[model samples]
Target: MKVIKEISLLREALRDKRKDGSTVGFVPTMGFLHEGHQSLLKRAREENDIVVLSVFVNPIQFGPNEDFETYPRDIERDEQAAYEAGVDFIFYPSVEEMYPHKAGVSLIVNSRTNVLCGAKRPGHFDGVVTVLTKLFNIIQPDQAYFGLKDAQQVAVIDSLIRDFNIPVELVPVNTVREEDGLAKSSRNVFLSEEERQQAPAIFKSLQKARALIDSGERNPEKVIAGIKEELDSSTSGEIDYAELLSYPELERVEEIQGKIIIALAVKFSRARLIDNIIVEI
Candidate 1:
């Protein structure tokens, strides 16, 4: 696999692949790659002729108090993982290269940006949309792969594609998790030993929520309370926000009828984590 840190060099690499009749598949990620990221790459390789995985820990997506500087990164290790995952090029661009001029304007998908993760971390998805728009513009991939672990982020990106008419296929891959059921994330490293043990409760709580919905529990308050109750009883983790919302569109729902997304964000002693389950009721 080729690693190109310079934006021009990366574009040149992509151009070569495009000229050779290769369909580009892009996986945008902050570094600290794990099996979850690898799964996205593997899927990309299966469908596309060339896979470009970007490893820029976008500063904009992080809040002022968030862990922008401490976000884990090791380009060498990331490049190796990318190579093993069948990536053709690693687009590792610097902040300066990404934003040479001031960001005079930004892309935002409204309504979709005000719940769950967005409610807790204001302006988070705006940064996500902006950086993702930049990456999509640069890579111009035939298909872009994103993990379903971040369901809200997936929704926001899809909205951007529709609202802006960006001509690239957006693919949502399944959420990858640890053996113990905790969702794999770069921030998982922040968990202390006890927090790591309690972290899986987030997933367990979501699973229970799904079970309740599957059992014909449609009242949003009941479903949400059950989830919160699980977290309250079994863990010391702080509840950030828990809600059941309409799938894809993400509008908050009082009663789930057809398809709805049950999502939650919880903070352990260390870092905040988010998870969701989409179900048909």
Candidate 2:
């Protein structure tokens, strides 16, 4: 696979492909390739004539004290993985290439920025939307793939695309998980051996929540309480939030009716892990 760093050159090449009537599928990611990322690329490969994967660790998407500097990255490893996942082009752009000028304007997400991960990490989605706007413009893919592990992120990007009238089709792929049920994440590398063993409990708690819901429990508080109890007994991680919110919209609900997401975030000794189960009642 060819790695193109310059935006102009990448666009030119993609434009040439378009002239040949090839459909392009894009997967945008922060480096540190994992099974979760590969799942998205694999789906893209199956659906489109050309698949483009980007590995730029976007600075704008990170907060002041976040792990941007220490966030895991290995371009060589990522390149090899992208090639194996059937990527046609790897858009490995530099920071300057992505953000050339001092941003006079930035995209702000006003609505869905007050709950779940959004509530804790302020301005995180804003950063996400800003960089995505730039990437979408440059790649100009017919379809873009994103995993549902970051379901809130998928919701935010859905809104962004609708409001801006972007032409790309946003494909929401299911979260890829380890055999033991933990959601696959790049941050999983930060966990200690013990922490890693305890990590699967996050998903287990979500499963407990789902069981409660499926057994005719409709109260949000009771469902969340049961989920907390499971987490309390199963792992030593500090609970950040165990919330049952309306699906996609992520608004608080009095009763767990219709489609909802039971989302959890826990802080292990070193790594902070998040997982969720979306259910329809």
lDDT of 2 at 52: 94
lDDT of 2 by residue, 6-26 (tens): 999999999988998899999
Off by over 4 Å in 2: none
- Give Cα-based local distance difference scores for all models: 0.88, 0.91
TM-score of 1: 0.97
Model 1 CA deviation exceeding 4 Å by range: none
Q: Could you tell me the lDDT of residue 237 within candidate 2?
A: 91
> Alpha-carbon error at 272 in model 1, in Å?
0.6
lDDT of 1 by residue, 1-281 (tens): 88887877877778877997889999999988998898999999999999999988888788899989988888888878888888988888889988889977876657777888887678888888898888988889999999999999899898899888998999999999999899999888989988898889999999998888778887999988999999998888899899888988889776788888888888887688888888986
Residue clash pairs of candidate 2: none
